[model samples]
Target: MSSPVNIPFLSFISLDREAKTPIYLQLAQQLINAIQRGYLVPGAKMPGSRKLSELLSLHRKTVIAAYEDLHHQGWIAIEPNKGAFVMDNKTKMVERPYDALVSLGNYPTQTGYSFKQSNLLDNPFEESNCTYQWNDGLPDVRLTQFNQLSGLYSASLKRKGTAKKMSNNQASIYFKEQLSNYLNSSRGLHISKDNLLITRSTEMSLYIISQLIISAGDVVIVGELGLFTANMIFQSAKANLQTIPVDGQGIDVDALELKLTSTKIKAVYITPHHHYPTTVTLSAKRRVKLLQLAQEYGFVIIEDDYDYDFQYEKSTIMPLASADLNGMVIYTGTFGKSLAPSFSTGFVVAPKNLISEMQKYLGLLDRHGDVIMQQVLGEMIAEGDIHRHLKKSLKVYMERRDNCCELIAKHLGERVKFNKPSGGLGLWLNWQAPISLLQMAKFCTQKGLFIPKNILYQNRNFTAIRLGFGHLTMEEMEKSLEIMGEYLSSLP
Candidate 1:
C-alpha cells in the first residue's frame, strides 16, 4: 500500500483529558476547524486512522469515531479501502481564518458586523448576584399548587381532539366563558364572552389597547408617577403623553379636566386598585369624578386593576367598568400577581366594538395564546381552585406584609416614613433621611441584598423607594430590612 499522506497539521492538534467534553468530540471539533481554515486543502488524502492514532498517542477507535463524524457532517468522504479524503467544497465549514481558529479562551468581543442599539433601551442595568432579592409586587411562586396545575396540563394534552379543537379556537372560547363568569361574580363586572379578549400578560393587553386607540401625536394622559413599562408602550406608539400629578387620592382629576378642555384626549390610563410604585388606592370620590370626566370629555378610561384581589384592610373596590354607562371604559387586569407572575394571564373587558378590534390586533401580534394553558386555567377558574388559591395566598401575603412593615419600623425607625397600604403587595417608603437612594441601594447590595435600580425613585420632587414584600419569606424580609437599616443609620 502507498505510504499514507503525512499531515504536518496533526502536530498542532491537542486534547485536554480533564475537560468535561468527551475526547471523541474534541478530536472531531479540531479536525472540523482545520478543514474550515483551509489548512487541510480539499481533496487532500488523510492519514490512515491506525497510523494517525499511533502518531497522536490516541486509541484507533477515537480516530475512527472522529472520522465517522466528519463523514456524517459532509466534511470528508470515506473510501472503501483507501481511507478518508477532504471534500472539495469547504463551504460546509463556517468561514474563519486558520489563525482565528485557535480558541480565544472566552466569548468573542465582536463578530463580523455590529449594529447600534436604539436610544430607547439605554442605561440597562446588569443582573445582580446577591442572595436576597426584593421584587416589585410579585407573588410567592413557592406557594403555588404546581402538582395540581401539572396534572391539569397533562390531562389537557391527552384529550383526544385537543389538537383539532385548538386549531378552530374552540379552546379559547371555554376560557373566555369561564373568565367572564369569574369577573362578573368577583369584580362586579357586567360582561360576557363577546366583550372579553384574553392576552398573554397585562403588558400585552396594554400594547394591544395602545394600538387600538393611540395614534401619532394623539394626546394620552397618565399620572405623574406611573407604570414605567406602560409608559414605554405608549411612547413607542408615538402618543403625546401628558402627565398629571398624582396625590393621596390617585391622579388629580381637576388637572386632568384642564388638559381635557384644551386638548382632545384619546385615553387616560390609571391603576385604581393600587397605584403602581406608590400603592395608594384611588379614593372613591376621585373614581366617580374620573368616570364623569371620561363621559364629558369623550376619552377612553383605561382602568388597570392589577392587584384588586389582594386587598387586606377593607372590601375591594369594584372596577370602573362595572359602573361604566357610556361604554367609555376599557378595563384591563392580570391574574399574574394572584397566584404567581409566571402563571400570569391578562384579559380586557370593553365595548363589543372595541373588543372585536382589539382581537384583530391580538391575532396579528399573537394568533392565539397557550391553548393548553388556557383550557387548564379555565378549568381552575370554573372549579373554584383559583378562588381558593387566592384566598389562601391572600392570608399568607397579608401576614408577610405585616411582618415586613414591623421590620421596617424596627430597623428604619424615624429615618423612614410610610403609610400602611390598605391593600397591595408593596410599601412606598419615603426616605426622610438625606441619603441618595442610589447610594443606599449600593450599600444594601454590598451586604448581600439586591434592590433593583428602578425601585430607587429620585427626581426633583420625589424621593422614595417601593419595597415589595410578597415574594420574600419572613426570615429573608427581616435580614434584608436589617441590612437596609444598618446602611441608612450609617448614612449622615
Candidate 2:
C-alpha cells in the first residue's frame, strides 16, 4: 500500500468564514505550521487537489490557491513536471496567526503611488541618537563635533551683526575664503566668491537650477534606478524624466546617445562619485565621455557629491567639476552625508557667468543661509578641523565596513553574493534564494532588526538587498548578519 499524501489543514478553514482573516490565509498558515512541526516533510507529496478539497469540504480552487501562495512565500517548491515539495528555510520561525493588513490600505485599489496622511509625528518614543538598532543604517553622528560648531556660530554672529545683515549669495567672507581653497585643492577648480552661491540644501539648489534652466515638458536624463525622492523632485519641476540605464561601470553612454537628440534634454542629474544604492563608481573614461556628450548635446550635468568624502579607494575621485573647462557642470555638495550635521549648509559651484543670475534667483528663494552656520563652518574649514574630522570618521567607518563584509561572508558563505566597495558606505547584495526583500525585512524586524525597504516597483523581481553599515558597530554588524543568515536559511 502507498503512503497517504498530506495537504494543507486548518483549525477552521471553512466556507462560512466571514471573520477578519480570509479563508485562504487561515489555510495557508496552518499548512506552514504543519510543515514547521514536521507533520509535513520535505519531498513528501501533497494530497491530490480533489481528495483534499473533498476532505476539507471546501472548493478545490481555494486549496490550490493556498498551495500556490505557499509556493510564492518560499515555503514550497512546485516543479514543472513534479508536485509541490517543502523547501529549505535557514531560520526557524514560531507559527503565529497574525493580520498583515492591520491598518494599512490595500495597494491594488490605489493604482499609482499615493501617500497617506497621518499623525505619525505624535509617536511617543523619545528619540535619542540611539537609533542604531534599525537597519535604516544610522548615519555617522561622529561628524557632529558640536562644540567647535558652537564656537563657529559665535564668531559668525560676532563678524556679521545680524541675520538680516548677512552677506548675499556668497554668505560670509569667512566661508568664501574656505570655499575658494576647497574648490581649488580638492576639486581642481578655481572658483571665487563670485562663482559660488550658498544654497540651503542640495535639493533646493537643484530646484533653483531646474527652475532656471529646465522648462516644463523638457526631457531630463537621470539613472533608471535613481534616488526616489530626487526623481520625484524633478517630476515636481515638470521636467519629463528620461531614464538612462546603469551597469557596473556607470550610465550606458551608448544608450545616452540614443536619448540625445538636439536640445530635448534640459540637464542630467547624477551621483557619479558613488552611484546611489547601487554603489558602482563611474569610470574615468566614461566621465570624460559624459562631459564631451554634455558639451555636444548642450545639456548641463548636475553632479551631486553626497558622501564623496568617505572614499576608501586610492584617492578621492574628482567630480566633473574638475574637468568643467567649458562651465557646463553644476557641482553641489552637502554636509548631510558628510559631517552628520542635518541642517542647512550646501553650496553650488557653477559657471562664473551664471552665478550672478543664480544668486539673483537664490535671493528670491532666501537672501542668504543662516549666518551663524555659514560663519562657523567657514572657521572649521579654515582652521583645518574639517580635514581632521574626515580622517577620524573614515578610519572608524572603514573598520565597520570591513567587519560587515567578514560577517556576511562567514555566515552566509557563498549562497548570498555581494561586491565589496572600493569606497563609500553601503553594500548592494544579490541573493540567489527566492524571496521578496519586503517580506524578509519584515521578518528581520520581527527578529529585532528593523531593515528599511525600498521596493520601487512591485512587478519587478527582487534578487538583491542594500545593507547599510555606516551607523552600525562591528558587533552589531556581526550579529545582524548572523540573524540575516539564519533567517534566510529558515525560509522553508
Candidate 3:
C-alpha cells in the first residue's frame, strides 16, 4: 500500500473549537471531505492518532473517535496492528484541482438543467425585518387562543386510537364530517364530507381546481381589478384571462353576459363577499344575475368568501354558492381567520364528483395531511369554540375597522377617496392627489414601516392602496396612519 499523501492535513482540514458541532464530528466530516475531494486518495495510510493529535494540538482520544466514526461510516478501514486507510467510495469523477478560493461545502447556486419559468407566478410576498408592516387583509395572529388549541392538539396526540388513524394516508374523515356540519350552519353550504376537500390555504385550493378544470388556452374570467395572487394562479395554468369591469357593486354581470355570447368561458373567479383590493360587496341583483349566467352558459363560478365571519352589519348576504342550484358554483374559503395562521383551514365545497377529482390532485401534493390540526379544528367546530371565537373576534375587528376608517378620513382628508367596506380587514383608498404609490411605499420603508408593493395599485386610470389594519393594535394603527398622513401631506 502507498504511504499517505504528503498533503498537510492542517492546510485543508479546519476545526473551530467554538462551533456548536462536536470537535470529533467536525474532524471526521473534514477528513471525509478531504477523501472525497481527492486530497487523500483511496488505500492511502493515515498517520497514527497520537501523531495527528500532537500535530493538530488535540487530545489523542479525540482523533481516535473521529477515525472510529469514519470507519463506521465505511469511509475508512482499520485493523489491529495497521492504522486507518481511505476506502474506495466507488463514485467515479475526475479529480478536482485544489483552489484556495474553493469551498467543499458550498451549495450550488443554480440548477444543472433548464426549467420552465413563468413570470406570472413571481413571488408577491416580500421579506422584511421591519418592526411595522402592512399586508393584504390578514388576521391578527396574536389574538389566537393558542392555549386551548395546544391543549387539544396535545390530547389528540396522547389518544388511544390516533396512531391507527395517522398510520394511513387518508385524510381526516371525522374532521371533514364536523366541518361539513359547521359550514351548513354558518355559511348555508349544504355540503358533506364527500363534497369537501380540505387544503392548507385558499391559494392551494385554487391551484388544485385550476389543474383539474383548466387546460392550456382555456378561458378564465375575473374582474378588471381582481386578486393578484388568484390571477397569477390562473395565468400560470396557461388560461386565457379575460377581465370584466368592476363598479361600486362588484363585477359587471352585463359585460360578463356580453362576453359569454361571443366566447366560451371555463370559470369566473370572484371574491364576492367583499371584492379584493376594492372591498365592494356584490349587489344582490348582480349576484343572482351572475349565478343565472353561470347556469345558462355552463361555466363554473369560483366564489371566494375569504372574510365572511367579520361582517359588522346586521344584514349580510349569503355566498353565491348558497343559491347555486345546478352545481355551477365551486365555493372555497378559510374556516378560522380568528385563529392563528397555522390553525386556519381552507375548504372547498363543490359537487361530490368534482371533489373526488380534486382529492387525487391533493394527494399528490400533500401526502401526509396534518391530522392533529384537523382533530383540533373539528373539536373546535363541534364544541362551539369556533363560534365563540368568531363572535369575540368580530367585535374586536369591527372596532379596529371603525378606528382605521376614522384615521384615514381624518388624516388623508380630501387627498384620498374611500368607502368604509361592510366587511373585510382592509380599506381601499383611491389616492386623488398626484403622488406615486411606489414612492410612498419607499418613503414609508425608509421611516421603518414596510408597505408591500402588492397592496399598492397604480396606473394611469387610478392610484390606490389596500391598507390592512387587522394585524395592528390601536396604537400601532394610529402611529402608522400618522406616518402615512405625514408622507402624503409633505409630498408636492
Best by lDDT: 3
Write the number of the candidate with greater TM-score, choosing between 2 and 3. 3
> In model 3, which range of ten residues has the least summed lDDT?
93-102
Candidate 3: where is the Cα deviation over 4 Å? 1-5, 8-11, 54-56, 79-83, 88-101, 116-118, 127-131, 168-171
| Decoy 1 TM-score against native | 0.81
The best candidate by TM-score is 3
The clash tally of candidate 1 reads 0
Ranking by TM-score: 3, 1, 2
Q: List model 3 lDDT by residue over 1-492, tens digit each.
A: 444445466767678898899999998998888886677777778889998998889999999999999999999989789878788566443343444523433445989999998778779889787778989888898888888889989998898878887876333888899999988887887888899999999999999999989999999999999898899999999999999999998999999999998999999999999899799999999999999998889999999987888798988789998898899999999988779988888889999999999999998998668988888788888899999988888899999999988888887888889998888899998888668877788888888788998898888888889998899998888878787888987876
List model 1 lDDT by residue over 1-492, tens digit each. Answer: 122344554444778899998887888888787666566767777788898888878999999999999999998999998779888773443322344344422334778788855665455344688999886777788989888888888999899989986899888999999999999998898889999999988889999999888899998999988888888889888899989998888888989888877799999999998999789888899889999998888998999996788888767688888989999999998864576565678999998999999989999888977898888888899888998988898899999989998999999898778989888889998877457888878898999999898777887765888898998999999899999888877865
Residue 73 in model 1: lDDT:
94
Could you tell me which 10 consecutive residues in candidate 1 have the lowest summed lDDT?
Answer: 96-105
What's the lDDT for residue 346 in model 1?
A: 90
Residues 1-492, candidate 2, lDDT per residue (tens digit)?
113232234332333377687776767776776666555565556666677778877788988898899999988888876666667454443333332312111124554776854442233222223223533234667556777666666666776455544644344666766877876887787788777878878777887787788788988888977766567678777788888888998878778877785447778889888787677888998899999988987888989886677788777788888888888899887753556555337788887778778888888888755766766677677888777877887888888888888888898788778788876777877666556667766666667766655521233454766677887888777777777777778878
Q: Which regions of candidate 2 are displaced past 4 Å?
A: 1-138, 155-171, 261-263, 455-462
